[model samples]
Target chain A: MPLRWPRRLGLVGLALPWLLPYAWMVSTSFKTLPELVAAPSAPLPSGLNLDAYAAVFEAMPVGAYLLNTTLMALAIGLLQLALALPAGYALSKLSFRGRGLAFGLVVATLLIPAQVRFVPVFTLLAEVRLTNTMTALVLPFAVSALGTFLIRQALLSVPPQLIEAARLDGAGELTIIYRLLPPLLRPSLVAAFLFSFVYHWNDYFWPLVMTTDDSVRTLPLGVALLREQGTGVRWHIVMAGNVLLSLPALLLFALTQRQLIHAAAGKAAGR
Target chain B: MKLLSPRRPTDPYLLLLPTLLILGCFFFYPLLAAGKLSLYSWDLLTPPRFVGLDNYRALWSEGLLLHSLELTLVFSLGVVTASTILGLALALLLNRPGRLAAFARASIFSAYIVSWVSVALLWLWILDADGGALNAALQRLGLPGWRWLSDPRLALPSLAAVTVWKLAGYAMILYLAGLQDVPAHLLEAAALDGAGRWQRFRHVTWPLLRPTTAFVTSTGAIASFQVFDVVRVMTQGGPMDHTNVLVYAIYEQIFLNLRVGRASALVVVFFLVLLGLTLWQLRLWLRREGAEGQSPPA
Candidate 1:
């Protein structure tokens, strides 16, 4: 803890590898196309030129990509929460036959990553003529095993007496779950929602496989396609598109750093 | 534990039904379908033709499957080892209570939350063979500029480096959380016993962080095994297919090659590998928990 300034400087030095790319990204995004071509590796742009940003917006449907990604991520989050809340509550608070089996089933599904299932899932959707639609993006991710598990862990921390007291007051099971438990489970719920939102917002693999239409293509895919369009690499325009793609997740991280870090740690601990 | 006056046997099941249904349709069903589809050759145009064991045999004979598996293993190993070490180091350095430490933590972890495509494009720009910032910096520093992506030998390592960059922050956050639970009293006790700083950390802190290390390494390995977007965007598993991790290979098989049977077989293999890894982690976790339960109080 001594020599605090030196240590802090050293920490900043170490952080440069992680921070520099983002700095360069934003800097490059603001560079004019001619400047970008002239000095591709320049640390700082000449000035805050908006030519690349303008070009990117003109060339690609940046707004639509953002909106599609946001709507898809929101729908996935809400659906996961709606399904997971009851499932978590049942698994944690309620006792019944086959409860252990049901919980085990949920946990077992965690072993299968979506990457492994995408091929068949893609085919199934294509059979139903659902590919290239928003529903295709949302439906497959509707139930999150991790969300259910996390919520279950959160619910287990709540005292049985509270639910019992509610029961004594003749509160319906639906009311107890939908009303009382959600307030107490706010941290987990928020964590689940944020995780789902950030994950799907940034998801490229599923959207890449599911949708070829620009209408349903998410931001990440849109940015990737932006790079592939021209004869040569347009560094400035690509960087501008990337900056746009990264802003939402970065903003989310900034706003909810503590919750996001804790949720991740809780996941690692397998709670 | 019953919250209702008359315990309805089906109440919990009713609550669980929606979740189970979705998982069944989307998760478990597709898993089984992947297995079944592996036995039959199907293109989008043609009906699936049964070719029992042929897809697996063909992959095994061609050796692409094994090669992809090896490349993935190597990639995952490099990523896991590098990231876990760097992550722990970052966690240790940033664990202090101060604004600088907090800022450092947040800044480092910011990369982990960004989309892989963005990370890929960002790195692609940085690692561009011609006119890349990294090469430009190297030339400015009077050093030789190596092809970071195009070279067969350097490409895999480059992708691994990018992955490590993104994932080390994730591992660091987990290690930071683990460091918080290292039981300060134990460290103090060790200090009281005349242990040096290294000795105390070696004996007390390292031993306590075993669970976190296991979690980080296993999860990192699992994720690295399935890396796709970076490879898809940056390399396309090119420069002699050096960077063709399993997932990308599976993707190529399905979409590009239109060999559904082969892709499904690869998926089955990938799932089995993941299942094995998960089972191994579960065993490690259970053993650790058991040891903790039986250990005498300090």
Candidate 2:
């Protein structure tokens, strides 16, 4: 097919609506207060300004939010992977008396949205005084039914002869899972990890519900707090804070774009 | 098959223990707890006193439950309908072979990958009543600007617009994958048979895309029903409760109002609604698969 200019312009027109918000976000973040007030609708800033970024840091604990978010997302991802691996392997490859029932139970859990569990879980955490702590943020999501389901689907695609050969060589189940399967399942694992990481990193509801202390707040909550300061709101500073909050996830998306898209598409196709 | 059996009868159980333990503590227990707590009235300061069915009656009589459910349904309907149609349109546009297409795909999908708070805050700035980018642009275009968020009538729609923007890209990716599965030979054959462009899509492409459409719409509905962060950040259930969806309403009942029993009742109702939706989707999916399996190949 020959490339037509009209077609190209039309495609750009379709894409512009999606892309402009991001461009505007970056542009507004770099605008000085005077420039923002003067040219609110201007697509570009006249000069680079670090003052908004500086003001965000001055107003909020950006460093602590960064650290907390990073640690929490990392821990959730690692923990979900750690739990999902063996369970998915067993559910996929191993036969047992209650295998069907166990798989059914896991699938059933998927139907129960996390919102329904928040009140009771919050009470349970508060009873033990775990609220305002990292544990409260991490515990509820330690085991991901969806992750296990995805892993199980991925594991089912592995050649049975490989696992049979390992069994013939007297390798234990754990050895096969940890050693042999990891390499073959790397894409699925990474996909699972990225989903958990991004979901939690961008998660505001859980932290908002679980932690009231500023010290324990994550990046999204921090950005929200910036807005909630109320009256004389600094649009530039708020955008700057949003930029900081969004950078890591956006960078991760850029770096792993292909794998992420493939995984998402693959999952949707029920592959 | 025998080779796949565990070394010990206990091996599978042990492998599943950690997952079961956590799910039991966090998921199963909370579900039952929510049920039991719904019957009792308690603030954080006092001992629980069981007032059986009163909480349910209160939510029903006060009319907040029905009102929030209605709001949530309207909000989700807008989000799901718009996201599905827009997503399919985007997928069809970007499904071609080119570098520009790929870049456009990435750019559109980037919105789905970021946090809701970031998206919400960005829109909050853009939709500000005065000095906002959108209003400023409107004035420049010689059109009057509307108060997007503060106005009761527009708040829910504004939130839905933000949501659709975030989600349409995601739906596009799914539809793109779905489009890939549409057999090329079938399309080529249809084209060679003198089928027009719209005819080819209507007869060949549209039928093949049903599964993807179902997946996109179902998941979109579920996510939209559970929307919280955007509503919390952008409107906080609104200037006059216009955007007060179910989850936000539940949050307010528990955290803000300290009505634990009432919130638990609301939570139970929310879970039931979600459960019904999930089962309906599952049935739709399975029925579609059944119908597809029975259909003759073109």
All candidates' TM-scores?
Answer: 0.96, 0.96
Q: For model 1, how does the per-residue alpha-carbon lDDT over B133-188 read when each residue is reduced to its tens digit? A: 89999899999999999999999999999999999999999899899889899998
Candidates 1 onward: DockQ, in order: 0.57, 0.59
Estimate, for each residue in B57-107, the C-alpha lDDT of model 2 and write its tens digit.
998998888999999999999999999999999999899988888989998
- The 0-to-1 C-alpha lDDT of every candidate, in the order given, reads 0.88, 0.88
lDDT of 2 at A77: 98
Off by over 4 Å in 1: A1-3, B1-7, B290-298
DockQ versus reference, model 2: 0.59
